[model samples]
Target: MHMIQVVFMTVMVFFVIVTIHEWGHFYFAKRAGILVREFAIGFGPKLFSIKRGETRYTLRLVPAGGFVRMAGEDPELVEVQTGQTVAVRVKDGVVTRIYLDRLDERSNVVRGEVETIDIERKLKLALNADGVIESFDIHPQALMISKGKETQIAPLDRQFGSKTVGQRALAIVAGPVMNFILAFALFAAYFQMAGVPMENPDKLLIGDIVAGMPASKADIKVGDVIDSINGIKIGADSEKMIGIISKSVNVPLTFTVIRDGKPLTSKITPKKDPDTGVGKLGISAAIPSRPVSFGETFTYAGKAMKNMTILIFGGFKKILIGDFKMDDLGGPLRTAQVTSQIAEQGFTQLTSWVAVLSLYLGIFNLLPVPALDGSRLLFLGLEAVRGRPVDPNRESMVHFIGFAMLMLLMLAVTYNDILRLVRGEH
Candidate 1:
């Protein structure tokens, strides 16, 4: 089912992406002799964990977030965990698990349920305070576990200080690079296995024609169904549709199409988007062919990867410079949709997305955003430039501000995504 594909793609994207990003930090941190504590996937209460090396690599209950925790250091990435009830106690930097039924609390019965009456709330309720404040919908079941961390979250070590600026920057930049590497490999492997997508003819179908664009201007309407171009019939023997268009660039070409019970002629000139150097008439193209070429496959794959990277880069730039709106931002839902589409289109398409996505992952991480590997590296660069460590306090402050801003931006994009979903805008 298309829906199933979407769900699968979404999971694949997250796992692949998250692993690469975190691995960047993990690898470099280990190399830099930092005391890494936790390498976790997903955020929230840990559903499970494995203690390995000097770290607890965790798989948390919340699939939405994950992070690597370093001893004496706060991560730019935060792990948010969810749990029904986890009874754990910390003492002398040791964490020991305990059962929750053994704990006691003063209870007041209300509506056939036991609850602890909030003394402050009772006062406020007695005053007939009305507002969201007056509505005390406390979940006593979700009690805050008071046990302190048994392990001391140490400040990032002076050993981190001992590393050359380049090393520190590498440690910071590696996470994003890992994401990109993962993406490219994933993409290339798929391409190698499934074969490069050749521009096929018999399977070609147009889904959309841009309004007022060359295609529409030539009366090439949707459902017109193209059969040939420039008297070269399109069918089983048709090869190089792109080549044909490239040859016809800036020159009018006739399109033979079937409309209703009659054949029609529509003439359009292929024009270049200039920026991409691709032939276009604003027509959407798709095919049903599965072609495999053992020879030159890598060459074709490499070319596709390059194109994907270019497109992704341009898209990211648009977003950065405000040419793209926040509503265009994708969160989990959109990712799921894309994953499904990619999977349905076949592994080759999916792989292509992976490569493109990987490049995106790599480049985006390079951004100088706090809590991001790139931002950390940027600060390290500033330190190196000054020939001294920037004041740690100021560094911390800037990162903190960056982190807050990043969170806010994420919230905004997520909100936009939800709004679009509500409007059934996909």
Candidate 2:
């Protein structure tokens, strides 16, 4: 049952995040007149799918991630291009063999592998019965053979590589842009429902308590309104009360609380924190909630989003600088565990977690790593500077290598997560 809950939470979070991310790419690709072949949520075998217009939307079994399949995105021949000679061998008005030929600089014939096919087409060849020297017209819908297989050569404009750098960049960047927008919207709704923090802490009620800290050790609950501290009266001026508590760092302070209107007292000592060299109780007073104006709600949401973005960026920098511990990194299992905990905390906490995760995912994909949006943007940048796209085969190989490395990294992280779980460490 516990495992089911964790799995459910993980699926819910991933479905929203991955679907939105893929939708971002799909929307922009459509907007740019690019062909999107598939927009799928999840991975592995398909559970169900539906086609709308040019795109097929699918729901797959694996809930870990999703993807958008764009036509000509991979290095493959999708259609036949114009001005290319195609040879067709016909029998009973049906093509039995097709061959594609290109001319070298010296006008020598460079024939590709032959392919047998069945089609009906008439070619006006400049050849005798010996069937030696001949030329043919390059026609659309004409039978074409490539590497002993019948395939359509993609039209130039239909290919992603044929798009202008700006268009390509727009499509690549859209996924992350939509993710940020999702974070903003989630934060906005959360702020509106829960109310943003006040400029001043308005009450002496405890809003947050750090576990294994002084307050938690004293059995202080979040909603317990503080009546007094160390025989000093607690007032609405939270700063003054905090100052008094801070001053009594090493000394035991008597906290008078009103739980359900019944007064109780508890003595606890605030220790000096090693990191900050400051007296701390590891508790934050609640800020009184009030209805916020529309403008204020958006303002608060935007600020929250910006702060989370900065936090993620700072954490990433710390990782790069070796400031973060190896144990700090987590994989899917850990995420699911955290998700379950946050869900139990209530909707506000869960939504906040979602927003943060979405923001992180967005930023992560924007990194200039191969097989990510940032790498594609880098390629587009190169194309913009070079006045031509990178060779499709080479680009594909680079992404393939990067993708394999990512898989290995995922496996390593997952193994670490399992070890931590076995040791009962979250």
Candidate 3:
């Protein structure tokens, strides 16, 4: 049952995280008039899809990943300039409009019209007479969304990038916030299941044996339940058991075992394993688990969240400094294995890990590198400083580069994860 719970939790968590991530993009893009071509809830082949307006909302077979496809400055579009916009020159009363150069979707040429019978004269009058050039050289689309055919806008500003900077940034950040929310809710349910475990501390006890010397020759299991050792009753308390085992370490100790309730006597010398230099038997014993208080559980949950974030950042720093190999990272298989182990330990442990994962999701997404909330935040700060927005083309280019970097990073991490799983990292 615990194993089943582990599998279920792992699958559910992946699905929830992916769904929430994509939803962030979908929500903000919709409100910002950004046309979404496809809003997917997972990766791989589509399991099911429904077309709504211009968007095809899809649920894929693999629930570990998802994406929101939006438009603007996509590399997939190609076009030719028609030479519609040109530069206007005015000296005295005569005005002259001349074609400077033809530019396309990505072209930096500014286009607009000025109504003046004597355009040249008007420029001198406006420039020399007024001596004030307010809003000159300003590009309307500089701060606006780069909307075009390649942008995948089914209608107009329906692509993800078409939204305002604030909208886009918020959309990107929503995914991680949802993950934290899910984590909090999962743990809130876990705090309810606390009690004494079924097995008592005394009945489940540990016994030791020597290596291949004498006890090993008798084929003694490390965790064999000894009815009595050194003619002293054990299992009544840990102190008595420890005393008996300590005194008979190197000597031939009589161990009475009640195997299947049958009285049996065995004599064996206990020795440490030469390889590990630690007293041990061929096997290990399952010790009783200690129950914790509600306060302890809450504290553990918060600490677990902090620890996970620290571990993630520390690992990232190590990798950045070339001190840690990418193999330290894990993908779905490792996550599933970990999830299962946590579930086996108890609900609190599992939920605590979930909270940790949530923290990871939030922190990683906020990094101010291209295709992340942080990068958008950087632009926002710049706009605030400059009192205006940046060129749309340049902003889009930076984001494109960032997206490429992120994809490469994800691919590398996934490869590392596969390797860790195949090699049994734990």
| Full candidate order by lDDT, most accurate first | 2, 1, 3
* CA lDDT scores, all candidates in order: 0.61, 0.73, 0.57
* Cα-based TM-score, every candidate: 0.60, 0.71, 0.56
Deviation from native of the Cα of residue 303 in model 2, angstroms: 1.9
Error of 1 at 66 (Å): 3.7
* Ranking 1 against 2 by lDDT, winner: 2
Q: Candidate 2 — which residues are off by over 4 angstroms?
A: 1-9, 45-53, 60-64, 75-156, 209-221, 229-232, 236-284
The window of 10 residues in a row where model 2 has the poorest summed lDDT is 111-120
Pairwise TM-score winner, candidates 1 and 3: 1
Kindly provide the TM-score of model 2 when superposed on the true structure, using C-alpha atoms: 0.71
**Judged by TM-score, which candidate is best?**
2
lDDT of 3 by residue, 181-257 (tens): 66665554454443223355665433343234555566345445656766776654655555555455466777665
Tens-place lDDT per residue, model 2, 277-328, is: 6668888887667778899878988889888888899998997899977688
The backbone clash count of each candidate, in order, is: 14, 7, 10
Clashing pairs in 2: 79-152, 79-153, 79-154, 80-152, 80-153, 80-154, 95-119
